[model samples]
Target: MNVRSARGAAARLAGRKGEIWAAIWLMARGYRILGFRLKTPQAEIDLLAKRGPILAVVEVKRRASLGAALEAVGHDQRQRLRRAGVTLAARRPSLAGASVRLDLMALAPGKLPRHIPDAWKGE
Candidate 1:
């Protein structure tokens, strides 16, 4: 493989590792993982979790710093998450009454994952 392809592969592998680490962290914290890489026409939610009556749509952003990671999830991403959550609720009527929330999971190298619950309000 060329240099560019090798770098891309490495990056992709790193991201997958980060996602796995994040999922493990969440599981240890008692959050039951419902889905991963949930994709719709509008957007993709990295993880879907359930803790009691709360349904959390999680966006995982892994970077060297929290600022850089959090910045990755911009306005467009938030809107897509909202739409995806709505679609999830529509498809699963059981989740209709559950409290839906947008959560940001920021993972920085050598740092504990930051779980920002209710990171955004559907506005």
Candidate 2:
């Protein structure tokens, strides 16, 4: 395989692994997972979860460091996530009326996953 394709595959595998870990962490903390790798016309949501009245739209990142993982989600990505969240909520009756929040789950090797709720404010 070409170097680029191999790298892409590795990255995707790592991302999916990170999402799984994040989901497990959330579930242990009483969050019910609603969706994983949900794709909207606006963008892709890595994870969607709920706890009480809040609907969490999660972005999972696995990087060399926690700070790098958090920084991986940039301005344009955040905007896309917001749009995707709105689209998903509108289409899913179960998600209706839940207070939507953007969350970041950062996973770095040898460190516990960090869950940052309400990670970003509206743009």
Candidate 3:
């Protein structure tokens, strides 16, 4: 394969591995993982989890720094996440009454995953 294709494949593989690591971290922290790569018409949520009565829609960024990771989630991305959360709640009635939160899971280079719950207010 070409160099570009090989690099793309490698990146995708690394991303998948990062997601697994993030999920494991969350599970160990007493969060129950509900789904990964959940897609809606608006956008894709990297992970969906439950910690007690709260429903967390997580965005995972595997980046070189926490700032870069957080920067990756911009205004449009936040809107998409809000829409996706609405869609998710509609599809799963059980989650309708649960408190919804937008979360960020940043996997910085050579560091543990950072879980930022309610990362954004969507204001």
Candidate 4:
């Protein structure tokens, strides 16, 4: 494989690992993980979780630094996630009553996962 492709593959694996870590972190914090890598026409949600009446569409980013991870989810991505969240709730009858939210989880080496609840309220 070319160096670029190899880097891309490694990045994908790291992201997948981060998603798993994010799910477990949320579960540890009392959130029930509904799904991961939930894909839709609008966007791809890294993790979908629930706690009480809240249904969270989570985006997970893995970077060497927290700042880099946090910066990864920009305005456009947030909007996409919002649409995905709405679509998820609309399509899932079980999640209809829950209020959907866009959440962010930033993962960095040797640091705890940083979760931002209701990270964006985009339409």
Lowest summed lDDT over 10 consecutive residues: which window, candidate 1?
114-123
The models' CA-based lDDT, in order, is 0.83, 0.90, 0.88, 0.87
- CA lDDT for candidate 2: 0.90
lDDT per residue for candidate 2 within 33-78, as digits (tens), equals: 9999998888899999999989899999888887897789998999
TM-score of each: 0.89, 0.92, 0.94, 0.91
Task: Order the candidate numbers by TM-score, best to worst.
Answer: 3, 2, 4, 1
The better-scoring model by TM-score among 1 and 2 is: 2
Candidate with top lDDT is 2
Better of 2 and 3 by lDDT: 2
* lDDT per residue as tens, model 3, 1-123: 999999999998988888899899999999999999987889988899988888889898998988898888998889889788877877897787778788889998789899999887655
How many residue pairs of model 2 clash at the backbone?
A: 0
The best-first sequence of candidates by lDDT reads 2, 3, 4, 1
**Which stretches of model 2 miss by more than 4 angstroms?**
none
Evaluation by TM-score, superior candidate among 1 and 3: 3
Give per-residue CA lDDT, model 4, range 2-96, as digits (tens).
99999999989988988998999999999999988988998888999999999998889877876787678888888888888888888989887
